[model samples]
Target: MKYCAANYQFSFHSVNMRRMNDLRGIDLNLLVVLEALLAERHISRAALRLHLSQPAVSHALGRLRQLLDDPLLVRGQGGLVPSARAHELAGPLAEALAQVRILLGPSGFQPATARRSFRLAMSDYGAMALLPGLLRAVRKIAPGIDLVVSQASREAMTAKVADGEIDLALGVFGQPPEGVHSTELFEETYACMVDAATVRGLGKLDQVAYLARSHVLVATHSERVDAIDAAVAKVGGRRKIACVLPHWSVAPALIAGTNLVLTTARRSLAAFEEDPRFAVFDPPFPLPGFGFSLIWHDRTDADPGHSWLRERVIAVAAGDEPDDAISLRS
Candidate 1:
């Protein structure tokens, strides 16, 4: 496998050196634009993904074609089709871009001086119980950071997370969508919340006593039959559903003067335990607790700021304490 002539070896080495020099002369940003274009296979979609104008991406493509001396892309049935050279470049280009991203990532996170805002989605109960401690920690350590919390249905929240609309979501995720990643944050057991006045003789609920009274359920939708129903079914009984309410805040007040009983997370009734008007008790039947998890996309997996915040959230959840940000009431 030797070169037949010394002249042929010399020519090969010269061409290879010039090719390496030519690659070094191209802009890094143009490679980024090329990666997106090859991926999306359409000018408009690539532009949207890069947050760049269509004219700018088109112009970049023109430059790429000239530099590579290849057509790069040709129109086809669905969208732009990559040339043979473009196909050859696709795999290597993507891997190179990924390496570049890692090379340029933040060396480390400085929570004390970093200014960032993250959008978090959770339920009303979650906000009351978890936000106080998390807010306290953030204020004491990272005063420049901000958290915007909101509520959405599980389905909608999953979609928002996949699309990068929501930075994180804390909730009971049975099975999260494909594009997002999730990890267990904590677990919570159910408890029955009711007024103390009418429960002297019927304090501890057996199945009969539990089902005898009217119950008000807190759910985003009435069609959701939760664990309570499944447990009740196993016991061969069903509780009377007097009403289905959306928010947990209003359910306790609604049960104050009526026979309505509210079944909810035990931690949610923390402030109401010692109050004269309320009572918290274990469910008459056995019901498994739910695993609350943190949902986020893989795009933020290596971000220094996001990693720091995630650890803080897990710490707060483990050692939850109330802060002045919110107050629980009857």
Candidate 2:
């Protein structure tokens, strides 16, 4: 069938206007319940998450289904599953709620007395370098705040942040994806870490020795190649990869008695600095390093709680007092 472009555009605009007008009559709180229901995918679980009675959540779900003109969820063999329309609404709903939270302003945040949970997406390197100081500061000041750390690929991090699943992401991102906002936390340099015994026998590592020896590669989420490999290729060299591990925390134990050399961010060395088993050195060939950034969605840019957390993160990363952290709003 043929279609007229102008007629189609007018119909789309009218439908959107009708939806907006319908939205004006619905209790805005239903959106919150819809978000929880979509995420939990079960009425009881959504109620528990929202701290509401099951009946209240069910009622809200009914209202949501009517408003959106879809059975947003239904029983499945595995308890419950979101309908196609529910899946479609999930991302935009989350974004809209985040915007509403931001619009309410920062008056809701009271770190000293607030009990809040923050989910952070970061690599093991970032967690190691930042968490120790962040935890200490949190305990001293915002004792009621809790942190949940998770790992995500660069691709996943952008979506997670935009959808309000991750409150912040910490990592080396050369260019942030659209809709993601970021601030440079610090610049990092690569360093070689080896067992003291191995380094003692080999002395200072040169390009020849570096390429000849077996190495342990630390791989982050969804990253098959790392900076070390790229640097080697740039210098027209290659090394034997003895093992591949996911987290930086395991690198020390893996390198303890082996001849394997590990190359990682210099700041990460602080964790193993005093350990007698490890030695740190500069790579024989110059390796490319990265700048770490604190990433978040623009929706949370003006949120006082998020802003306060960002300040703490910046302070921890920069080794400054929490009081000294700069305000993003300013």
Candidate 2 lDDT tens digits, 168-264: 9998775777778999999899888888887786545788878888998888655667778888999998878898888788787888887888888
lDDT agreement of model 1 with the native: 0.78
Best by TM-score: 2
TM-score per prediction, in order, is: 0.66, 0.78
In model 1, where do residues sit more than 4 Å from their true spots? 1-105, 320-330
What tens-digit string does per-residue lDDT give for candidate 1 at 1-330? 365677789999999779758867778899988877775679997787677899999999998998788999989999999899997786567546545654675576666776766668998877877888898888887898878787988887786666555668888776877767898888899899777777876665667878899898888755758788888889998878998878877777888887678888888888888887777789988888988888887666666667777777887888954242431111
Q: What's the C-alpha lDDT at position 267 in model 2?
A: 85
Task: Give the per-residue Cα lDDT of candidate 2 at 17.
Answer: 83
Could you tally the backbone clashes for each prediction?
0, 0
